[model samples]
Target: MEDRKKDHIDLAFSSRLNGDMVDNRFDYEPMLGIHGKKDLSFEFADKIMQLPIWVSSMTGGTKRAGTINKNLAQACGEFGLGMGLGSCRILLDSPEYFDDFNVRPIMGDDVPLFANIGICQLEQMLQNRSEGELDELVDKLQADGLAIHINPMQEAFQPEGDVLKTPPIELLKKYLEKTDLKIIVKEVGQGFGKESLRQLLALPLEAIEFGALGGTNFSLVELNRSEAVAAEVYNPFIHIGHTADNMTHTINQLVDKMGYKIKVNNVIISGGISSLLDGYYLTEISKMPAIFGMGSAFLRHSMGSYDKLQSYVEKLANGLQLANNFLRVKL
Candidate 1:
């Protein structure tokens, strides 16, 4: 105790924070709440998640992907969280990389696991009348549903990117009419505009994951891979997307205006969600039932070892519980 007090005294001068460093979004009511036993459990994707955290899709079909996915699945299983696999495009015609994404056994049957595919790939399947492969892909992985990531900007920036022959909404409508498979639609870095969100809310989607701006921008990713001139010319386009807060406000207004017209009831407030506070704030403001997702954050820890990933997930759960117990969003 003496040593601890000495250390505290030594660090006290350096630990002083400025008034501008305060977080004003939440009202910290320490007196009204105790850090007693708290339950952060919530139902999402038809599964009860102990922590409202989703491991957003990051990578697959790479050398390190197997180890990373194994670590991630084990973390989710241990923490009782949900996960979305990186693009399962490689699994469409080949089973060679199937083991990398086959994480259901590791995560168990209790948590939600969703397979991901790009909207461009879906369009191609529809064009060739090979959409049946999608269902087969989902069944092979034992996934509860599928997440269709829409990345028009990323595709446009890629030199060898697939052409989006049809609008994503039209493709989604066509696919929904034929399949009973549960579906989620998300963006890649750049989030949806107001009109896009309106059309999506009208669909029978299981959920909408806002892969909003401020995270890993795939458009910027593709741009970096391009020649210098192309990258320079297209740099401005990378900043044209919406943030999590912007999307949340837009959805809330739409809900108020549309009433029963809003078909999708759940949302995964992803992108730019750097901390538990960001997740808590966005989810609190959203009118729909919401959880938060992280891609790069989980991928970074999962690349090392299962023990590292497990520790990180435990910290995430504890931090979120603390936020829920003490912080309230200021209206």
Candidate 2:
């Protein structure tokens, strides 16, 4: 069982694809009325933000992951966006062994910070702890909310992936009952469809991050580790999911027509958002508090010296400001 799980995780992480290239078909437009300085101070429940973006969860299970999380948190603190720590399962599983990992330094007092754990992990958490323990962890971390990531595609491609015995929506409801912290249901990469959204909405969720298909292809990730039959079977499906644009349209239409009012605390469109223009377009079209959480880009940038990291942040800021300016015109 353990070997199978290891194989699954290895396959999921092995995908040698960059998020920026896969979702590059989008065109940039200068939309008027998008800029009008409409106070961008949004919130994840009570957490306030100068901008509507957050650095989405990237990594933190291993030492290398911890370094990435540290840099990411620092970037989030510098830029006024929220930061999400990657899966804390390893840390939670063996706190002493991973005691070196820390999230406080990368986070800011005012900016939002999110704790991440998979849906399967949540189900296990529900069995072990009382409600208070969950609440305490939120309070301890000073996190504004908890992100329950849904990544069945990665799992399905994983050689030893956990057999998802039950629907995650049910587990999500269980978590909702136990914590006061807002619950955010997010996809890792594969975008959510209407049926999936419907199931998610049935649970008490604060927001949704449509980690759409156009960005990071989990199938490609699996393909890197897969051999023989599995690789061939999965490789063809790399482009099978919805793009960020499609997801935005679908979710907006659902709210507009279906009257399926899920708090929609925010709509994070984070598949192929690489440039300032990309971020702007997503915010304009989705019309929700959006985020351009560039996991792979950030990872690559961080591989260099601190100066390079700083430069990357500068570029991101410039892009955001440019987008803001472009959107302010009254079309």
Give per-residue CA lDDT, model 2, range 1-331, as digits (tens).
9999988898986867886665443434566425434455666666666666667777655667666677766766776677776776665657663432366655668787877778766766676665455565566666777788887767788776655666887777676776777777888777788888766655666678777887766556766777789887777767677777788778766666646456555777777766666666667766445555556677787654656777887776665655565534222
Candidate 1 segments whose C-alpha is farther than 4 A from its true place:
none
The candidate that achieves the highest lDDT relative to the unseen native structure = 1
Error (Å) of candidate 2 at residue 130 is 6.4
TM-score of each: 0.98, 0.80
Candidate no. 2 TM-score: 0.80
Question: Residue 249 in candidate 2 has what lDDT?
Answer: 74
Q: Model 2, residue 94: displacement in angstroms?
A: 1.5
Question: Distance (Å) between predicted and true CA of 251, model 2?
Answer: 1.4
* Poorest lDDT segment (10 consecutive residues) of candidate 1: 31-40
Q: Model 2 Cα displacement at 321 (Å)?
A: 1.8
Name the best candidate (by TM-score).
1
- Tens digit per residue, CA lDDT, model 1, 68-171: 99899998888999999999998876789999999999999999999999999999999899999889999989999999999999999998999898999999
